[model samples]
Target: MTVKDRIVEIIAEQAVLDVSDVTMDSTLEDLGIDSLGLVESIFAIEEAFDIQVPFNANDPTESDFDISSVASIIKAVEDLVKAQS
Candidate 1:
């Protein structure tokens, strides 16, 4: 699966929703996912890509990573993956 697809998958899994429910414009709250679910999704993303996500679970707003929407998250991870190469 592509990075975006994988990201949506992880988020959907954490939120206990179907992949079809996850859209690029959808935010975590839109999926009815809580803070813990966001953290878990981040962990899953990190593990899946073998890349450390620059996210601060304690203070999400303080982090440079953007979790505002699925599309933004996918863009960030795609950038990180490219940087690793």
Candidate 2:
């Protein structure tokens, strides 16, 4: 699957929602994913893609990785993957 599709799946799993329910505009808050879930999702994404995401769990607002929306997360991951490759 593509990066976007994999990310949606990971986020959906963390939120305990169906993949079909996740949209590009949806935020982690909108998916009912709390801080712990967000951390878990980030870990899963990192493991799945073999890349380290520049996210600070203690201070999400200060982090470079954007989790504002599903689309943003997808874009960030895609960019990371491209840069690493």
Candidate 3:
């Protein structure tokens, strides 16, 4: 699967929603995902892509990783993957 497809799957699983239900504009809160769920999702993404996400659990707002929207997260992960390559 493509990175976008895999990310959508991961986030959809975390939100207990179908992949079709997760859109690029959707936010974690919009999907009823709490802070813990977000953290878990990040861990899952890191493991799946084998890339370190620059997220700070203690200060998420201060972190470099953007989690504001599904599109942004996908872009960030793609960038990280490219950097690793």
Q: Please tell me which predicted candidate would have the highest lDDT against the true structure.
A: 3
lDDT of 2 by residue, 4-79 (tens): 9999999999999999999999999999999999999999999999999999988898888999999999999999
Per-residue alpha-carbon lDDT of candidate 3 for residues 1-85, written as tens digits (9 for 90 to 100): 9999999999999999999999999999999999999999999999999999999989987888999999999999999999999
Error of 3 at 36 (Å): 0.6
Q: Using lDDT, rank the candidates from best to worst.
A: 3, 2, 1
Q: Residue 61 error for model 3, in Å? A: 1.6
Residue ranges of candidate 2 with Cα displaced over 4 Å:
none
Poorly placed runs, candidate 1 (over 4 Å) = none
lDDT scores in order: 0.91, 0.96, 0.96
Candidate 1 lDDT over 1-85, as tens digits, reads 8998899889889989899989889989999989888888988999999998999888888888988999999999999999998
- Model 2 earns a TM-score of 0.97
